[model samples]
Target chain A: MSGIQKNIIKTLLLIALFMLSENMNAQTCCAAGAPIGSYLEIQTGDKRLFSFQFRYEYNNVNRLVENENRIENDPRTRYGQSFLWKLDFSLNKKLAFSAIVPFVHQSRNTISEQQSSFGIGDFSFITQYTHFKGRFRSLNISAGIKFPTGKTNHRADSQILLSPDMQSGTGSFDFIFRSSASKTFSSLPFLTSYASALFRLNGMNNDFGSTSTFVGRQFAFGDEVNSQIGARYLLTLKSGFLTPDIGLKIRWANHNLEQQQAAPNSGGYWLSLPLGVSFAPNEKKSIAFTAELPLYQKLSGLQITTAFRLGFQINYTFQKNKTDDILN
Target chain B: MKNLLFLTILLLFGCNKDDNQAQTDWLIPFDEVLDGGPGKDGIPSVDAPQFDNVSDISFLNDNDLVIGMFHNGVSKAYPHQILDWHEIVNDDLSDISYALTYCPLTGTGIAWDRVIDGSKTSFGVSGKLYNTNLMPYDRATDSYWSQIRLDCVNGTQINKVINTYPIIETTWSTWKAAYPNSEVMNLTTGSNRNYGSYPYGDYRTNHSNIIFPVSNTDDRLPAKERALIVMGDQTKKVYSIELFAEDRAIEDTIDGTTIIVIGSKSKNFIVAYEKGNLTEVVAVTDQLPTIATDTNGNRINLDGTIESGPLQDVQLTTFNSFIGYFFALGAFYEVEIYE
Candidate 1:
């Protein structure tokens, strides 16, 4: 069977596994996720390549605490699910382009109240340059911009503007910078490792005056920094190869400012462990899945905690000289 | 700056704007109701409220505001500090379902019967404000009702009049003093919110700054003037809280229905009751605030009891009255001020 057909079967199996696990246990709660962590492998061939990736993430926010104590008598909780589609184009060995499109659904439940929202989320575009390549390693640097392309004025059943966190997008411009490096061990050639750091500088949405129920006229989100390191070892089989990976990710965010004032319960830090697997039936196609579980979390104020973050991606590489490319 | 402006234009045109058309017959124009904040179900209503005896409430200060209700032989209190955050509470007392609503903007506290056409339904905040008053939507039919208007302005129950019950907007001290055994809502509301501070900064004290606009304003009273309001079948009347504080008693007629208003501003308690018979009234006691006197020379107590007349010990029937800012009354009614 071709790689595409084989990856499809593996994708279905992973989905079944996720369903079984989800039905067996409930995840813990907290919130915060962005489209990230793909494109770690830099292309080396002379032919241009195109890759498509999809990711699903869930964040649960339950506790709104102050001073680490759960605030009593207010039961406003939210769960956010996001689906992201990313396209990457490696035009040559030195240059690449990428874009992320997201859709989000948020559900809120109070003591006796519940509400939900579904819509397109923010979109991001990025450009990258490969600075160096060696027999065993590669280095790349990237810069990106995110546009406020989603609805920010969704209302509750009460005809009030939803809290900023519940909306599909932040309604702000964000600038992003990232650097990544990957190395293969010649002594143990089956092992490959990579590390990356990403930073986001957020802008403000000044339209909260007409859209907000609270007193704030403007809403500005906090800046964010994320660092991740992972390693994978390949296991060759008769039909394909299986790469099992383990990673650690750390995220830090500054407190969000509202109307130029520090908004309460708005920022925090999280440490997570990512466990993943990639199945490659051939070089041109692969299916990968990752599950992230937070090991430690300390928020500056009360916030919804993230129970687990899960991602799935099916990557297909199209080579210029391939039969598929000629047919197209 | 040029790059920023170009990006801003792209951002503005990239998303779809919400355009919901009016679907029901409205007493006021739909544009009059503006967005308050928090998307739909953003400020969730308390579905299952927890309660404790008045003595168990240690968080409430003497002057902290609370909405008091006596229904089906039960007395319950909902604090403004709590209601300000949630907006609505769907609760049942002695098997009768009721919705307790408070609009911080209009300073109106009302308890509504949750039954319409013999069916029980609950309410949620519609995230909408009419004349700075809360507009609640019934869950069963998704019809939006103006709290002050007491009518469903849109949706399946359009133009439907909601049944209202009586509640007293008073201070915590006054409510506890009167109904010492009453059940006060507990602060341990299984959610997260600061139950101590008012969410809207300095709103209770700010009189001149109107954040949301109302269609009409009556300069007869200050915009935030608190008053006792009585709603009859066709007419509505207001007894100024200041007048109730000064006279300690107000006897008036609305559309020929005789009513008496009494309360203590210092004590933070005010109530109105329907009068059934011929009456003469006077304020005779300084120590206890015994203000009512009948034609037959009987002193009546603030609890509507006739003190010395032939009908001594007889209690007058209390009306379903509530306290509101004059601005809210003007927003909903052609109100007659009791002279």
Candidate 2:
């Protein structure tokens, strides 16, 4: 491959790696509104000045587990789908801003009953600062605020306020912190490795489940930490580059507090493997598909865990300067 | 961009409300019945439970609580460790079939006859709760019954009362000693569960660990305090276990009906019987099958069977009663606490 072809291949691999790592943070269960992990914007390389991306995520939680043991006979299942739109604008080589808007649809099913909710979910605004940029490596840190744009008071058909887990929004303003880094090997310029970590400080919803007879109570989702490490390789094709990636993701959450007491079946640890493939038609656009499978899960109490997760993403970028290379 | 905006608007407004259209009529307030996370049969019921003789069982700790029942000269014990996970156990003894229903959230256990409308049917957890108490539904009629209220709260059999069998809730050591030949529900329940573990952490003992709000709050005692509550016609009274710390029986009246409550904090049990003719009943200690006695030397066994005296072989009728957490009893009824 020529030098320009190699550069395009590296950039494509990095984009695929970042996309795979960013999408690995979808919450396992009982998360209010859109998953906080979906707020992490993809790290579009310095060549792109602005980018718009849309992702569709489907998560199925049907595995009932107690600690580390799986209860095979539970019929309770929950399915969540989120449509996320993200916009990223780079002001300079070292600074960028991102905004994410999500629409969420959630449904829980049992043998006798079914409950579902759908609406606009929480929104996140983030500012990222590039800490270091080298020939083969880059580091970026970001901080953001999550707005309580979703509705927490969505009621069931019986006119009862749905539980926090079933609601479209948390009704609380939360804070998000994230950092990501990527590196390419000197010998293998077509392969890129990346890692990202995120921490979410959850806020409380004071008006949860308010009724005529009883006042609203306080509910807070547990704080969470999600981190992932992955590697992606690019293959040059006749029309585009095909990038395949794999990663290990770890998610840890503290027990949720309802009325200031630890809620049972609320928090746990999960380790999963995310596999994905991306097709970049050119430097300005790409499409990717990913699937996450749980390798190990240890929840606090008896809980329904995620069986698998599937996600599809499309990205379109506006470059600061146009290149006339065949690969572009 | 137009299609994206249209799709966004459609998803934002088209399917926002989550409605369960099947629930039409409810005897209680519909909004008060909260889904307890798990769905129907999510917390599986032990349909055909295996039992081990008291001497053959080895999994129970001395202080582990068990619900003891006796019928046709046969005794059986259901440990709290097992009940915390399964919540219901349907068992059959000869012609008698009953479901041992337990709610860890409310700390209450009551045995109800599986026969509803002259038909035999088992009960399953509805995965719904009122005042944080278990709401069980009968499989025959698919009707939901409130365990604390002992009445069908919803479905086809709404407002129907369920017949309850008296069960003795006591420590495992006390139960084994009282009925050495009793059969205890074993761990081979066919469900893959950690039977030795308590599913709800610190919920049983934490005074402020109530996950759901109660309609009525009685601040007279701590929320999680276990007490025996006797239900009468429009009247209910609670006798705390602390009142029987010294192993005594007290005669009390509820709506003009006389009753005798016998208990001991050390033994971790409280039992009550209708005071028909026997008088001056007093609690006893370390006597197997003999928990109380009257002035006429009538030996009252744990199951209320009179072993001797003028009422020999006659069983004392028990009042409608069960042990429950203080908060649950207060939330469901206007209960008067006996000092």
Share of reference contacts found in each model: 0.13, 0.40
The number of the candidate with the highest TM-score is 2
- Candidate 2 lDDT, A171-269, residue by residue in tens: 899999999887879999878888999999999988676666456667889999999999988799999989898999999999988878899987999
Mind giving the per-residue lDDT tens digits that candidate 1 earns over A150-236?
Answer: 666555454445556656677888898989887889998878787889888989877652522333346777888989899988889
What's the residue-level lDDT of B332 in candidate 2?
Answer: 94
Candidate 2 lDDT over residue span B69-160, tens digit each:
88888888999999998899999876689999999999999999999888999999988888889999999888888999999988889989
Q: Model 2 segments beyond 4 Å from truth? A: A1-31, A36-39, A42-49, A153-162, A318-328, B17-24
> How well does chain A score by TM in each candidate?
0.81, 0.86
Ten-residue region with minimum lDDT total, candidate 2 chain A: A22-31
lDDT of 1 by residue, B151-185 (tens): 88888798788887777677887677767888999
